[model samples]
Target chain A: MEENKKKSPYKNKAEKDALFEKEFMHLITPLYNFAYRLTFNEDDANDLVQETYLKAYRFFDSYEKGTNAKAWLFRILKNSFINEYRKNVKQPGKVDYQEVESYYNSDDIDEPITQDLRVDSVKDLIGDEVANALNSLDVDFRTIIILCDLEEFTYEEIAKILDIPIGTVRSRLHRARNILKEKLREYARNMGYNG
Target chain B: MIKTITHLIHRLIGKKEHSYCCKNCINDLYLVLDGEAEQKQEEELLKHIEKCEPCFTRYQIEKSVKEVIKYKIQHKQVPPQLIHSIKEKINGII
Candidate 1:
């Protein structure tokens, strides 16, 4: 089976089109999911998906056969999202890490770290809270979380999609996950999850 | 001084999970919990979790948080009319 796939000449236009039609339906859910994660809204996701498909169809000839079709599609969709949607959204102000570190360091050393402190009494960690927390993250952090955590892209794949070094992808993903974990922990505490 | 050196050595070589599991590993834990960790790193993290309780607990917590978020996102369904309109637009473009 693997050998057959290796030798297949689905590289030609007619064969490619037939294969695309046969396989495109399988991509709809994934494409929709990608769009939805990026836009965080249904209408925008739909629009993005439509645009992605249109663009994908136009550039169909450019695609290398028997390669990662999904990643290729996602790359196109992500480019569109950044160019069209993200460009319009005003980015949050940058954090001054030095100041933040100084502020923390200035605090009393004897003050207990709340390694075990309870905050509130809500049981369910609602989605809005999660979304809001994710939204609060910088665009870099947010994109890493969406791609790595939600979409399950590999570090290598994410690097390709975002056009960054693999080291950058790893570091950003780590920082992003840490941020989300901290926020979710706070949210969990607010909702009263003691454990 | 010897005792203090021993203490420092214990702390340095402690059973605690690495403070730097890298962002890729941390984020990958979510997919791991969802039973979707990729081949190579999946084995690596699985071995790490076998001995690292802190990271294991962290994995559980991250998974739970993801579940809550996933539930919320799934609940926010797009309206059928909107979906229809988008489909119409898509067809028109094609």
Candidate 2:
């Protein structure tokens, strides 16, 4: 029948609700953490995570079942952040991807600093300094670092989440880490770590 | 005689020196750390790290940085209310 064809594959609403709860609810902690890091504010992070979940629930039909729910949710949250907060509030002028790419490429300064043992060791560095240094980075760089280092996502996963090629993920992560190391170097030196 | 035996033992345990500087291993350092490298590349990278000091140090530092980020950044706990609210929102809709 036409009605039968329109119906979802789910046997009942109860089954759908239970499955959604089991799979998606558990990801709240990680989702919020990611949201917080991206927005750097409690209110924004809360709104972001809420918006992400709302969107996910609305589009639940499109989500392929039995796949990576975490990655799926993460992708939604990341895209929402880019479209909503990043474009509207952060930049009045449109974010020029080309300009950002060229800016990253123009800086060859990170090469010498990282190779020369400028920071000595990050072992003794305090949490505040690390957090500061991390937050200081541009959102693009920071997102990659958070995804790769903090969330421990693989490059391929990151490439999928960021909608870029695997090669871009590699190069961007390399550049991001180098920039992070440079930022940490100043803090390390301030802490009197001379190596 | 004892030194020679110890050296032989080290080599037996896969402690042989790396003769050539491998560009692939060096380039894929973070890839290996992030568990993104292919199986064969991972093996080659581990071997290269064992023999190369610079690569080993680089690996250590990157690993340490990862750990630090995971440890410190995770302290931002999500409030209990937020979870309850999200549940409420979902419950209302479903």
Candidate 3:
């Protein structure tokens, strides 16, 4: 009986279904958004979210109740995106972020020049332009922004999700926001706005 | 009185101009904005932000940027068809 109990996380199929729906189902929309932002393609986002759910369900027994279901789901989707889906998307090929990380790490002054824009200007910016500015950042920077700002994850949660230290999460996020500000400033310049 | 004035003049001519370091302020300001910094540290930075000019401007810009990102970014919803398909796949596994 003990062996059987260990094998089955839930007493029955009904309990499993109830737990899964109660804990995980409501997160489908936010999960889809995370997937969509990462892929920037609707069809691929659908496929990624589907794959994420299938894997989540398969591994449900391992997940503890009343825990961070959203972070767990996001971790699965992120892993799948890196391991499987990214290959399918056309790209110049894999750019090792290790080099990028190292370069950024080596400098104490890693913050990009993101100043000079008036706070009033930031408020005046439209949604699409802001989105484009965010989307234009490197994927590493972009992913951190989505997780930190968009998802509103804590530094500790983000560290666990990305498998990096809390310090790295803070530093990377700092650089990402600076880069985004720089991107927006350049956009304004292109539009003939006097910065 | 003369000694106090001499110390003041020395401090004024010292390697550091003011006690608040803008470089350190910029770094710590990120922590303060994240709402995760230590309470004591947060209070200190808050006091400093209230005083420093460049740091105050910097804080306002960073805070505004965060606000814009939170509310201004366009959010796309999950497609109804995708939800249906995800449910179908989940059922298939069981």
Candidate 4:
């Protein structure tokens, strides 16, 4: 009886492998997008996505069948981004908007020598310049913008992803957007637009 | 006389001119813009916007900021070589 139970056709390792492959294949694009946005570098993003997939495959048995597979995979990738990938990178200090405002307000700044700067339209402003500004933001601000604005994740989901309170998610998203707006405004000013 | 007095009191308190969206509602405009407001709050905000000019303008600015940021993110294309490399890696694994 025990031998017959062990020999059941449904228990085949190859069948399980096939099932995992089918499900895992469908999640690759979103996983790649998430990693790319987080790392902002192609090679690093690729590596992160690859590692996430490998880790998921190794632990496939632990995943519940009917639950959200994408969220589970994203949780893994987010953890990897925080614990492993971000460890080697240098994070900037918190932005003090007050200090930034005071510095820019100082009388030592030179006035614009020419008023001939051309303003680019929203379409023209949406490329590398925007990406560079996003990359330049501190990781905290960048992650909030990525989760809340770009990914359109709910504040509750973002709280789970970042392991912060929901209120923190809301407040951080607000601060992040304000900072991004300030940066974009600066870019607009340089292009001679009245932001 | 009593009805006239009540009317005068209402006008004196500026209830007729007051916006439906109060300070708290204005503060929550970002959440509304994100589509993250709870259902009741969302409904209330919509009703408020229908009557209030200042709050309506605030809503427009928030909406514009969201659109501009979204446009910026959407326009950023992943490099072709990166796509090729990812495909190659997936094929190798398969």
CA-lDDT, candidates in order: 0.62, 0.76, 0.78, 0.63
Top model by TM-score, which number? 3
- Taking the tens digit of each residue's C-alpha lDDT, what string does model 3 give over A1-195? 334335886777778777787788899988888888888889989988999988998888788765689999998988999888767757776566777777666764634355466687787788888899998877788889888788888888888888889988988887788778887777667665644
Candidate 1 per-residue C-alpha lDDT over A15-46 given as tens digits, one digit per residue, 9 for 90 to 100:
65556555454566767876776677787888
Q: List the residue pairs that clash in candidate 4.
A: none
After superposing candidate 2, which stretches have Cα over 4 Å from the reference? A1-6, A90-97, A106-110, A116-120, B1-23
- Candidate 4 runs further than 4 Å off: A1-10, A90-124, B1-23, B74-94
Instruction: Judge candidate 2 at residue A99 and give its lDDT.
Output: 73
lDDT of 4 by residue, A1-195 (tens): 344333433366566556766777667766777788777777778788777877776677667666567767888888998788766665564355446444433521222211221223333465566666676777777777776776677777788877888976765665566566566666767665654
Residue B93, candidate 2: how far off, in angstroms? 2.3
Question: In model 4, what is the error at residue A31, expressed in angstroms?
Answer: 2.5
User: Which 10-residue window in model 4 chain A sums to the lowest lDDT?
Assistant: A108-117
Q: Could you tell which candidate, 2 or 4, scores higher by TM-score?
A: 2
Query: Candidate 4 lDDT, tens digit per residue, B1-94?
Result: 4434554576798654322135476557777877877888888888777666545655665565566566666433445665455445544553
**A143, model 4: CA deviation in Å?**
1.3
Clashing pairs in 3: none
Q: Could you tell which candidate, 1 or 2, scores higher by DockQ?
A: 2
